[model samples]
Target: MTSGSLHRLTAFTTTANGGNPAGVWIGETLPAPEIMQRIAAEVGFSETAFVAPAIGLERTVRYYSSEAEVSFCGHATIATGVVLGESVGDGLYRLTTTVGTVPVAVRKRDGNYEASLTSVEPKHTAAPEALVTEALTALGWRREELDGAIPPARAYAGAWHLVLAVAEAQRLANLNYDFEALKTLMLRDGLTTLQLVWRESATVFHSRNPFPVGGVVEDPATGAAAAALGGYLRAEKLITTPTTILIRQGEAMGRPSRINVDIPSSGGIVVTGQAVWI
Candidate 1:
C-alpha cells in the first residue's frame, strides 16, 4: 500500500552498475487496481510487480507500469523470484498473470540468486509493410539498414513486441526516435516495446527496447521482448533447437544488461537472469 512496503531490485544485472530497476511488492492479499496503479506510478519504474499468496508454490501476480497495467513483465518476474527464493527458499514458483500461467525457477548459483522464467507459448505474425514503414519513419531508420534474413514481425510471448533486426550494430545503437509518434503507433498496434536488434554472432545479439508505452524512453533490460524474440527465431527456423543464446542490451544507455534465452524444440521459451537487491 505504501512505498515502504516495496522491495527495490535490479534484474538482469551482471554488475552493480547495470540492469533494470523494478519495485516488487508482496503481500498476503493484493491491493485494488487503482491502488496498484498509484503505487507503480509513485515507484516510477518501467514496471512494478505485485504478488499475493495463491496455492502452494503458486502466486497471483500483476504488473503495472507508470502509465497502465501490462499483461506481463519479465524483469519484474525475475526480481520477484529472487526475492521469494531468499525468503521462502529456492524452488519453482508458479505465477498466475493476466495473460496466462508462467513458471519461474529460483536457485542459488555461485553465491548469487538466479531466476529463470518459462513464458507462455510464443507466436509471431508478419508485420505489414505499412506498419513497418511507419515505425521506421518514427525511428529515423532507413529500410536498407534492415536485415533481409530476419523480416519484421509482431511477436508475443507474454507481451507483444515488434521485432526489427538491423544489418549493423551501429544502426541499433543510434536510437533516437520520435517518442510521441512511436507511442501513438505502438498503442494503435498494441505493442509493448519495439525490439530493435542486431546479430553479432550466431548466438550473440545486441538489442535496444523503446518502451514509450511504459512512460520510459528505453528499457535497459527487457525479458518479455527477449522471450518474444526467441519465439520468433524458433518459428522462423533461424536458430537450432535446445540452444542457449546471449542478449546484450542497454549498453547504449550506459546500463548494460544480459539476458540468457534457452529455446527448446517445443514448448515455452526459458529466459534466465540474475537480480540483486538495490
Candidate 2:
C-alpha cells in the first residue's frame, strides 16, 4: 500500500462536497483495527469503509469511525460500491460486513455509476420513556417539539439508532447539542446516532443525524438509519405498503444528500443513491 494513495470517496450524493464523505482503503489485507480507527479519526468522517477482497468479486468490508468500529454504514458502502464500479467494472458487488452479507448493485446510469444497497434485516422497538426524555434533555429540545404522528422508537438495521420525529422544520434546522451528555447516553444505550426527521409528505422527508458517539457532531447522510426508518414505518403502518420514500439529508450541514428508500412487503429495506469519487 502506498502512503500517498489512500483512496477516498463521498457517497449518497452525486456532487463533490455534497454527501457523507467516507474514506475507502482497498488493499490485499485488512489494516489493524486500531490503525483503522486512527486513520478514520484522521480522515474526520463519520465512518470509513475498508475493503479486503474475500473471493474474486466478493469483498470483506469493515467500517470504523473515529472512536470505534461500526457494524454497518450505508453511505460508506455506497461510496465503496462506486469506487469498485469505477476501478473494476459496474455490476453486483457483495460486501460481507460485520453485521452480515450485503449485496450492492452498481450500474452506469445517466452517465454516472450509481450504487444501491439492500440492508440486512431491520427491526424497531418502542423507545423507553426515560431514554427519550434523557435524549431530549441532551439535545436541548422539549417534549412538545416532537411530532405526535410518529412516536419515538429505537430502530436497527445494522446499527442501533433512536428515531425522533420533530414537529416543525425549524426544530430540525436549529441543531445544537451537548457532546458529552449525548455521547454518554448513546454509548450507554447502544445508539449510533439520533435520527431526527420531519415529514413533508407521505413519500418525502428530511432527516438529520446526531452522531457524537462516532466522534462527529452530525452525519450528513445515514443509510442504515434510512433502512431502519423504512422498517419502522412499515411496522407501524404509517405509510402504505410497497412504497418508495425519498429522504433529503445533510442539507442543514450544507452537504445535501438524496436517498431513495423502498419498503417491500417482506424483506430487507433497499436504499439507493449515487456516490462520487473524492
| TM-scores of all predicted structures | 0.97, 0.96
Estimate, for each residue in 3-95, the C-alpha lDDT of model 2 and write its tens digit. 323567788888898989998877777878877888888987788888885235799999999889999999998888888888888889989
Whole-model Cα lDDT of every candidate shown, in order: 0.93, 0.90
Instruction: After the best TM-score superposition of candidate 1, give how far the Cα of residue 160 lies from its true spot, in angstroms.
Output: 0.5
Off by over 4 Å in 2: 1-5
Model 1 lDDT, residue 170, Cα: 81
Q: Report the Cα lDDT for residue 273, model 1.
A: 96
The CA-based lDDT of model 1 is what? 0.93
Clashing pairs in 2: none
For residue 164, model 1's alpha carbon misses the true position, in angstroms, by: 0.3
The candidate that wins on lDDT is: 1
